[model samples]
Target: MITLAEAREAYRGYAPTYDLLFGPLLQRARRRAIRAANDRPGQRVLEIGVGTGLSLPYYRPDVRLVGIDVSAEMLAKAEARARRCGLAERCQFQLMSAEAMAFADDSFDLVVALFVASTVQDLGRFGAEIGRVCRPQGRIMLVNHFSTPAGLSARLDRQLSRFAGSLGFEPYFPLDRFLAETGLRVTASAPAGLFGRLRLIEAGKG
Candidate 1:
């Protein structure tokens, strides 16, 4: 497994081009996650691995947004994006790891992870940290690509996993198992794309 430092280094040189490569598809996923969140007017939202703040614009004005990312370069991009959107005051950025968040327990009304699970070094630890900071009845929204259940897509996913390690991604996490281990219960799971390919999972603190 790669260390957080290694992942940070890998992303450092890629921050600028990161959005260009992933912006469109990820933006689509982010919109789905936001819809799953069903954010009320004044909710406190915590976003993990919030690279470049691409999802910041989707958040409602009344919702308080706190974003955390491991890469300093990515965080800088996120900061710039926040300023560009004129949401600097409402959006806060912090350099932190998802495996060990600094926030206190039960702090946020909603926590979101967008296309971020695959990058975590320790899925269990990341899930635990997410659970720790989430309020008792709060919601967690995740947008992720997973190993498809059968046939050709599953074969491709297997092939992708081999390359994923080098890129600091896990390819897929066993969604049900991870949720159970994390003390979260799935409230809804909807296909975000064709063939139930990319998924949007909305879970509540258990």
Candidate 2:
């Protein structure tokens, strides 16, 4: 039960060194996420929880991108990174909550969340919003860690649950449950990252 305020503060503290720390570790997953999207020129893409804009440089130059994060501190760094990487013209960074986005329905061709499912306070609402904003045939790309069906990873996630409230993520989040609740249809999924701990999921609105 990590409150939004606590999640904000946690990210504020992490903003400064986020790129140096989590950036390298999550880069592989991010790359995988964007490539799987297969975005086209002039398409609009929304990136939820686009921390520090690490994925900013990876998107093709022709696409239009909107990246939103709850933490202003993190968004500032993302803005700077976009400018530094010469992606400023193609990308926009804003401070907005994922669960309640301001955009209208059926507004984007693609939506993405990288390493974000664990951090969202209301995943159901977030999923609904993702579906609402994306066109019927649009894609929802996610690269995240989910509780393994069984084995060591599953056990470890359960053990980590005790610290979830303080850490701002619900460890042991079940994929089957999440998909069912969100009503998102998964068209593709593949193991990713170290020991296949992370997953790359491509889904469409049902």
Per-candidate Cα lDDT values, in order, are 0.80, 0.84
TM-score of model 1 vs. true structure: 0.91
Q: What's the true lDDT of residue 200 in model 2?
A: 92
Residue 190 lDDT (model 2): 93
- The top-ranked prediction according to TM-score is 2
Candidate 2: tens digits of C-alpha lDDT, residues 1-206: 45678778878888888888888888988987897685577879999988889888788878888999999998998889889988889888788988899999999999998888888777778788998999988899998887878988789888988887666567887788678766777899998787777889998875
lDDT of 1: 0.80
lDDT of 1 at 9: 74
Can you tell me which runs of candidate 2 are displaced by over 4 Å?
Answer: none
lDDT of 1 by residue, 85-196 (tens): 8878888999999999889999999999988877878777888888889999888898887775567767776677666646756654556645655566778888886456
Candidate 1 clash figure, as a count: 0
